[model samples]
Target: MPQPATGPTEANTFPALCAHTHLFPGARCRLQGLSDPHAFTAAPWSIGVDLRFSDDAAAAAELRTGGPDGPVLAVPPYTTGAGTRIGERAWFVREFTWVDGEVELRIGGHA
Candidate 1:
């Protein structure tokens, strides 16, 4: 059986585990809610998820099958596109975007 992924999202965690059962967080790793929609963050590889909520913060995982799955983004990429106009509650992100020296992913929704 595949063990539930533990610890942060950095690649370092797995390599150490295989060597000496040791794990540590990585520079790009973090913990988040599974099904909270806002809990999901887009990794380089796309992960299957149902229901994305307000904002592009993090995503939450859903145990059951229903609704729609979330799309993979560049963590906090800009949502600007040709003819792009977001509703009052639309979400988007841009690479290398940050505020107060911390990264921020835009979160919003459509009317």
Candidate 2:
């Protein structure tokens, strides 16, 4: 497993991670409910992540707290499988939904 990035200052680029895997720039992970993976870019100041969990229990646990728009959920620090570290400050759950045993979560973050 790759170690988490210490700070944004340590690197010039920060990529997105899903299930501890790196989604290389312009690459998207195929999930049930999401047509495109949530993406982050500094050039235009955009950030978002879309995750699909097949494990019902895990998905339920993630949504046990506030409602979809109630509270902001912080994304835990994680390094991609390729050894890249995502050092963003905060990422909150923007949307949550379940379908056919799959839980889809839409998360967003600030620049």
Candidate 3:
């Protein structure tokens, strides 16, 4: 008989896109780069991110028509040998610029 699925299986895994932004899977956006991927501090932090979308025109239009609230990006929790630990963090988009089919977002939040 087949054994039960282990941790972090692809079958139950989802992309790291921010669901709160609603510009993730629906917009075919993929994370391209992050200014600071690993930062451990409580002080206010700001990071720059680059996102590439399959449909540039549509993505730009969506961003323009977004609600008053900015997009929320998060880092999901994970499990380690010690135990499951919360690594979740939320960052609000301070501003975003789209140029040459690339979306650059400046996000800030408490880390």
Per-residue alpha-carbon lDDT of candidate 3 for residues 1-108, written as tens digits (9 for 90 to 100): 222233113222212233233332223333323222121011112222232223221111112112345455543443333343435444454544443333344555
Task: Answer with 2 or 3, whichever has the higher lDDT.
Answer: 3
Instruction: Go through the candidates in order and give the C-alpha RMSD of each one to the true structure.
Output: 16.0, 15.7, 17.8
Give the C-alpha lDDT of model 2: 0.31
Candidate topping TM-score: 2
| lDDT (tens digit, per residue) of candidate 2 on 1-111 | 222233222332223224424222222222232222232111111223333222211111121233343424334454444545545333344454443333334554431
Give the alpha carbon lDDT tens digit for every residue of 1-111 in model 1. Answer: 222242135232110001111111211222223322222222322332222222332222211111144322222222322333332221222222223332233222221
- lDDT (0-100) at residue 6 of candidate 3? 30
Worst 10 residues of 1 by lDDT: 13-22
**What TM value does model 2 have?**
0.35
How high is the lDDT of residue 99 in model 2? 38
Clashes of 3: 0
Ranked by TM-score from best down, the candidates are 2, 3, 1
Candidate 2 runs further than 4 Å off: 1-64, 67-69
